[model samples]
Target chain A: MKQRFLNDTNLLLVFSAAILLMPIWLSPLGAAYPDLLQKFAIYGIFAIGFNILFGLTGYLSFGHAAFLGVGSYAAVWSFKLFTMNVVPAVFFGVIFAGLLAFLIGYISLRRSGIYFSILTLAFAQMSYNLAYSVLTPITNGETGLQLTINDPRWIDSMYITVEEGLPSTNLFGLKMSGYPGFYFCAILLIVCFFISLRIFRSPFGLMLRGIKSNQNRMNYTGLNTKPYMLSAFVISGMFAGLAGSLLAVTDPLAGAERMQWTASGEVVLMTILGGVGTLIGPMLGAGLIKYFENIFSSFNKNLLHEVFSFLPDGVEDVVVQVVSLFVGGGWHLTLGLLFMIVVIFLPGGIVEGFQKFGGVFGYGKNKNSDSSPQNQAAE
Target chain B: MDSILIQILNGLDKGAAYALIALGLTLVFGTLGIVNFAHGAIFMLGAFCAVTFRKLLTLSVKVKDESVTMFAAYKDEPYLKIWFGDTGEAIIDYAVPLSILIAIPFMVLVGYAMERGLIRHFYKRAHADQILVTFGLAIVVQELIKASFGANPIPQAAPDIVAGSANVGLWFGLGESLVYPWWRLIYLCFSGVMIFAVFSFLQFTTYGMVVRAGMRDRETVGLLGINIQRRFTIVFAIAAVVAGTAGVMYTPILPPDYHMGMDFLVLSFVVVVVGGMGSLGGAVTAGFLLGIVQSFASMNEVKSIIPGIDQIIIYLVAVVILLTLPRGLMGRAGVMDD
Candidate 1:
């Protein structure tokens, strides 16, 4: 039993078990509800995908949310035109997002560093602005796309008769909502994790790491790095597409807000706040952020007073007043501060923090080495 | 013909604001080799400085009205109005301009502290890290402003003298319909003067020469024992003041909000990129060029040909420029090109 537990495969099993049993463990953390759980799983996939591009290639695309938005729109369109089955929606989502990423990456990859970031940002902003106004026929404008009861679902209707109300997305008649919806997302998350792990260990992944470390060296060796980088970009965008389809699968609405620059910033924050390049860190960061966004934003003076009730009356009032600022509507301030602190001190993020704590008592080798580009020039 | 002139006039004021903000952004990028995302927040703070000045001038004292007796009724009278009567009213009317007095020194301190305290450490760090830290600082500053200002757009009126419109068409013997706001004209002239002052200062001054030399090669400048760090702090402060004054002057046009800085920050970055990164002339030229193009895109005639061209024109132009030029309009080779 001890030998099996210490095996390399044991880590994947532990991760899967923890995710599957989120209801039991996260219940204590006040985030066991289906809506929040779905978000955690979906954002986990999004952040993990983002990590593949940003962590491995060191090319920070500030416009990644555009891919997420495209995936969602494509998934919803599949449902609108074809069937309520999730298989086609997810497929369309990934394919469309990958295509969009290919186009953006083709142009943006022409310039690296800050110029690349600006190019991506400009492209995403164009898509978003177009969606909000000119593309209202497709995006349904600011009101967002919704399903009506009488609408034709071409493929689903061929197999079955029309239902009374708007049909919910299903996978082989298994409803994709509530707890079941979360399970579907969780399973996909696990699959994604395995895929990401495989990529991390692959030779392609080594080439990506080399490209990040010193692209000049890789180029001088007569290797073409553009195709490799473009492939990474497409794959990550497809993952984002998967996450977006999951978002629409559970809730059938796609808005332009999904493609906003701020949304792009949030994913970057999630990956960075977790631990860049570490497989599990991005997922953990996504969950942590989503959990706080839900739980912390809900906290008010009354909730604080109850939590601090054990203290004396005077101290309780003081504590509640002070604590309330960091919660509720002021939560973003804390997030911003946490991001600053992470980037400034713990560049390796929470995983490194844990590794260091473990290192204090003499742990094993630290596999999550610092991925941040070292500042080479000195004043 | 008159409509074209009016559109050009409309673009000038907005273009001035963009140029001012972009100028500051490019200056910091060139001098400090830092991508200061918080520059937008500095602009917002400058607007709030006007708001704060107005708020201070309008501080009220509640006076009980003995005539109204159903319940107790009190009329809130501005303390300024009560303290000095007509002169105080006149002072309140000019609050927007007067705030520049406070914004300058306050922003200098803010820029100085930001540079010495937080930014200096990250100088040797990666550019990505610099972007992250500065972005974080921007968020924090925006949130702090929101906390103080109550997250609402605060409207500030221009001084009464320049509040109304001037008949520009009559000056050119066109039509009465081509009138424009006096404040906007003043803003254009002010921006032109400010831009000229900045350019001439850099062109003539020994201090400016050192800073320009530092931008090209920092190590050589430092070897001369010129205390380059102190001048860099001043440069940062000047950038802050430039953004601040632009913000202060701009409040009459667009209401000041905590989020305005962020909105402008992205566009200013676009302008900086479109102009060519770290190139001041490029930033200024791109700022006005995009602004004019944006105004032209919004014209009814243009919209008839291409629907919603106004909304995406800037980004579309950026894409085309980036694809064609690669170095931006005025970018030097090897300046963040890779």
Candidate 2:
């Protein structure tokens, strides 16, 4: 018990340290900026929450982005109507998303496998289409929901007067932007991760895992699986809501595009790429994908030229031309190829790849320890 | 009533495209048991085949114009026109239909390559893995198309002879106000022909009989010493050709874009699910049904009543159907429910 406790603490300490020191360590990778850092933290939370439902219970909801979108819209509405303070915004985000998720989860959880995926997808698409068009009065349509200087923030108006420009979303006057915003997101991520880790080690998590493995057997054994599955779905949806609210808190804008099917696909890829069911894998996957998106997409022909300058001019030109096709506007191409390779060669994702490589060097004892998540969960 | 009639007519062409694509999707699901998210990419590739054929046929020579000596500008005089005059022009005019000749052979090769190289390897993998890999392939195919053709939609004109709208309303005594596009009617007929050909081929041939048996139970058929794998490859190829032809025919209606396949992918999957996962007839029926429902939902009367019913009617229908039926319209009891 003592050894296990130490290992658990060690893992938490290592993870916290890595995230807290991201700005310092990630400078070499040119991804230390506040916006990208915030995205990493936010998407990490999204992926972690997604992993809880998908990795833990094996229910893949393709419409999780709907919860995220609902959260953002709710947050922005809160900011517009109630206050610039993020607390109320977050509450609204979580509550609205939870409500939407409960409704979708109630209907969608009726079926499993691809049926579940399609139902969730349909609900999300309906939400997206509604948000994009008919719900324009609430969502602000294609222009998106934005805060304005002239608008009344009821709570803020009661407390204090505002200036000419729109007030930034804040946590009791601590501005939720730049490094401060990233740290706030990082702190929340750590808390969420801790919650996720505890869930993974809990009896409830084991029950969920059982549902994932063989729900029919569990049902035949007289266990009601629906409530457990619904709980998992709602919890994950709330996490998505939290992430969505955090996005609005940082940027103070909510757009319909945030709930697109492609956005849902992105989270799914992140979870799969990081290692499903494993605690830290999804976060790493989120960071890698975000890094590629922000950094790689910015790679222009000129940047490629500078990177390939070491080679002869003729070779450099050819190399840049070839490489340029997979960067800048073509970064998605690289992502697609990388994802295919991972699914084909590394189904268990980067974590499994690392374990395999470590195993090659005779790290058998370490491999046997805590690598089989099922064993740990079972215990 | 006239509007309703026109709407049905309008739905038929789009319905034809949906049915054709869904038919292809169901064939793979039934025979090979692959989800094949990249099936729509094959459709897009077919549209591009037409685009490429036109581009190839219309290869232009630079004719110097003495009118612009400041830069000595040259005008592109199509090589076909330069070589054969009216005959070349006529050939270029017919590029969209003529591309079918190339689309069939090319799509077959692509099918064979995909099955032999990538898909067969995934025969034993989980459904999730299959979905992910195929989705990845879909993305790659779209990206490659974007890289080559640029992201903009390429317009493929139907043969000029059939470019105008037909007097279908007059034929039906509905008046001169209800004209439909000749190209669309042609597309409807073309899809009908394609669907018939596929059905006849599958319904009659000994090869298709073996395929049917394999679909029912692959191991049992294999026990009988039939080369089911080879037959499955041919079926995949047939799917590719059907989707390709559907795309080729759709060019005049909806301009061919790199992401066109992706837009269809979701809808086709919905069609497949609603029809029944592995039911070919169910797929065809659901495709047309959903297409018609979508068209009807888009009417101003319906929009005013429900406000954006058109955007979600198909999904709403799918959800209702899946929830109520569990196995879809013609889905077997144990097919993919788990």
Candidate 3:
């Protein structure tokens, strides 16, 4: 028990140190990259929340983006109504997403496996269609909702501001854009991560794993698992909502495409790519995917050619063209190949690969000691 | 009244395509127990095959006119055209029908290879992994098609006999205004015949009985010394042929595009789910029902009340049906465990 406690403390310390050190490392490279870090942190939060339901309960939702989109639209509406303050916007978003999840999960969780996936997908597509048409006033249809300069700011009047139009509402007058937004999202992600850690360790979490492995056994044990699954769904929805709200804060826009089935599939990919059941795996997955999306896509043929100038002319051209295929317009193809490889070879995802590597180096034995509880209990 | 008839005719044609695709999905899912998300991509590839055939038929070399430029003044270049006289040209002209012959064998090989190569391994894996891998494969196939074919929708014209609208109203005592496209009528009939052939095959053949038995219990069938996996692979091939043929027939209605598969993938999955997981009859019935409902919802009357009801009506029906009857319309009880 003492050794286990020491191992747990070391793991926590390493995680905290990594989180703290990430920004320090990234900032030196490019401090003022517009909303890049914010995007990563927010999406990480979404994936983490998704992992709670999918990772624990073994319910694969192909429509979690519906909640995320709902939260975003709700936040945008909150900004339209009460105040430009981020608190009210985010709060409303989370609440609305949770409510929506409650209704959907109530119906959807009745079916498991592929049926559940299809049900979620159907509901999500319905949401998308509605947002595209009937709910156009809220979602702003295909054109999307944008924050104009003329938006009212009730919170700004309380603060001392010399500017006439609504001053950008901030946390204690600190601008909630750029670096501040990234920090704000990072802090929220940390809180979400800690909460997820607690949930994973909690008895409820154990029941969820039980439900995942053997629902029949749990039912025979006289424990009603529906409410537990529903609660996890709601909580995950709220987390997605939180992510959506953060997205709105950074960009102040909401599009119907945010809730499309493709977007839902993306979170699934992120979770699977990272390590479905692992806490930090989703974060790593989200970071890796988002980084590839934002950074790799920006590298054009000219940049490729410049980088390959040292090679022979024929070889240089072939290399540039081939490399560009994975980076630019062929990103989906690359993602597909990666997904296939990961599913076939690394079924446990990047986290499992890391564990294996650690084992090879003799550092994984202690790690597995603490981790085996969750894995064994799940199985 | 004439418009209504025309709309109904249109709806029937669309329903035919849906029925075929859904039927294929149901067969694979029922027999093999694989969700087969790449089925729609297979459909898209079928359409591309038709486009490719059409392109191949029209391939010609262009020769510069010597009289037009100083550079070409000295020589007249011979241009080669691979024309095999009038009959062969006529055969090439009827590319849509020819595509049926090409798509069957091509898609069968694709199905066989896919099952043998990738999906066979995923039988024991989690459904999530199966879905992800297949979904990824779909994306890869779609992107490859896009790279090869470009993004624009390619129009594949029907042959001369079925190129234009036919006034079938004269025979039915309706006004001449109640016309349907000739190709669409042929497609509907062809699909009906195909479905009939499939039904007859399954009803009569010993192989079909073996397939049904394997679907019921592979272990039991294997105990009896039957190679159930081979039958399942054949079923997969049949499913591919069904979807491919559906795509071939549908090309005249909608131009073929790389993204067509993604568009149909969701709706087809909805159809499969609404029909129930492993029921063939359920798939056909639900496909037609949803198709008709979708068509009616898109009408001006329905649109006045709900602007995009048509777009979401199928999903609405699916959710309601799923909630009220968790086993779907024809799903076996307890098959879909929470």
Candidate 4:
């Protein structure tokens, strides 16, 4: 037991060190900016939580962004009613999102497979449309849920009164922005990672995996899978809620677009890209995608031209035209192409690709190579 | 009473588009057993094919006009008008309608290429993998469309003769205020003809019989020495063509946009599930049912009572039906029941 605990500790230490040093590591790639780093941590938490249900249980949800959106709304509302203190806001966010998830998961889990996915999607779309239109009084419509000067912050009135401009989210006096915010998110991500690791090693996680492999067999063995799957779903939802709240804590605005199906799809893409079901993969996937979006979208025709300036003029122009299609407004094209290629070639995603490359160089034993790609996924 | 009648008319028009799209989705699911997230992308592609045809028909040549200014001034006229005179003008005017003639073959080829190239390899993969790959393909297709034609909605008009509203309520003795768009009526008729053709082809043809057998049990059909795989490919192509034609006609009602396919994809997917996984009749029946339910929910009386029921009614209906009827309205036993 001590040895097992030590192994977990070692894994957590490595992950923590990597995250703690992200500013240093990512500086070379020009992604060490505080806001983007905060996003990396926030989305990292979301993807990890998503993996709890999708990676383990094999149930594909298409409405998780609804929970994220709900969390953001709750947190923002907390700010409006209470104070700029993030603790209570995050608390409310988690509670609200979890409650929503419980209701949605309970009803949605009644059906399995594609039916379950579509049901969740329907629910999310309903929420999205409501937020964008009729629920404008609560959600603020397309303008997004934001704080105003007239907000009755009861806690702030009781405690320290802000006599200046708009108050920023904070932990007492420490502002929730810049390096402090990134560290705050990073610490939370590490904690979330540790919890996920413990879950992965727990009997509950094993049962979820069992359900994923064969639900009918589990049933025949007299195991009730409903509560297990439902718990997984709720736990994952709480994780998403936490991430969403963190987004509010860092930036302090929540938009209806957060609940869009595309946002949900983004997390799935992140999970799949990094390696679904792996302890470290979701975070890595999240970081990679966020990094890609930032880097790819920033590239302009001038940059492309500069990169290809070494070539002949005509060739450079041609190269710029082709490469330009994969950047800027065409970044989605690049993202889509990458997704297709990964799904086709690297079913286990970047992790499997790394493992395969290592095996080729005779550097490591590729134990997963014996298993088929589908089964190897998320393992 | 008149409002109710008008809502029904609106419902049928909406139902036509939903049924058309869902029918194609069912064909793919029934025959290929793959939940194609990119199926909507094919529908989008179909709409774009019409857009492409329209662009081609109205391709212009510039003639320098010295009368306007000292500097060269160019006046543009569609080459089609120059080539075929008034007949070309007429064709350009009816571009959306005439597009069908070109779109059918083009859409089929696109569908065939999609299946043969990307989807064929995924036949035995997990549903998750299929969903992921097809979704990626969908994003790719839509992005390409956006690259070629900017992201704004491109408005396509119906022929001038059918552009105005007709007195739909007059036949029912309701007030003339309850009018319906003529193009929408044509769209409904178009949907009816397509649905009947698909059903008939499956019901009465030897090729479709073998394909039906293949859907029931691919291994068993293969054991009987039929190239069921080839026929299934054809079914996929036909499904694409159906979705494409629906998209072509729908361009007039809802302007063609890159994201339009995705919006319809989600709703049509719900329609497919509410109909049942593999049941063709269930798909069509549920399509109209949900469409009417949605249209009625959007009525002022309904909205005043329920508040935002219109936005969510279709999904709410889907959830209620799935919870209660599990297999959906016309679901065949054991089709994705688990």
| Per-prediction fnat | 0.68, 0.69, 0.68, 0.71
Better of 3 and 4 by TM-score: 4
RMSD, every candidate, angstroms = 2.5, 2.5, 3.4, 2.4
Candidate 3, pairs of clashing residues: none
lDDT computed for candidate 4: 0.89
Model 4, span A298-332: residue lDDT tens: 99999999899999999999999989889998999
Model 3, position B227, has a per-residue lDDT of 89
**Per-candidate local distance difference test:** 0.88, 0.89, 0.81, 0.89
So what's the TM-score on candidate 3? Answer: 0.92
Two-chain DockQ for each candidate model: 0.58, 0.57, 0.52, 0.60
In candidate 4, list every pair of residues with a backbone clash.
Answer: A276-A378
Chain B TM, per prediction: 0.95, 0.96, 0.92, 0.96
Per-residue lDDT value at A102 in model 4: 95
Per-residue alpha-carbon lDDT of model 1 for A163-273, expressed as tens digits?
Answer: 777889999899999999999999999999888888887999999888888888899999999999999999999999999989999998899999999989889889888
The residue-by-residue lDDT of candidate 4 on B74-176, one tens digit each, is 8788999989999989999999999999889988999899999999999778788888999999999999999889999999989988999889878778777
Report the lDDT of model 1 for residue A376: 14
Once superposed on the true structure, which residue ranges of model 3 sit more than 4 Å away at CA?
Answer: A1-13, A26-34, A150-169, A366-379, B63-92, B333-338
Which candidate would rank higher by DockQ, 1 or 4? 4
- C-alpha lDDT of residue A94 in model 2: 86
Using all chains and alpha carbons, the TM-scores for the candidates as numbered come to 0.96, 0.97, 0.92, 0.96
Residue range A1-379, candidate 3, lDDT tens digits:
3455435456666766666566677666553364677878899999999999988888889899999999898887776665667888889899999999998898888877777777888888899889998887777899998766565555544554547554453555567887787888888888888899889889999888888888889989998888999999999999999999888877777999999988998998898888887888899888877877777767789989999999999999999978887777777778888888887887777888898887888863534222221231222
For candidate 2, lDDT tens digit of each residue in A65-154? 999999999999899888999999988898998899899999999898888988999999999999998999999989999988777788
Q: What TM-score does chain A of model 3 get?
A: 0.91
Q: Where in model 4 is the C-alpha error above 4 Å?
A: A1-6, A363-379, B64-74, B172-175
Kindly report which residue pairs in candidate 2 clash with one another: none
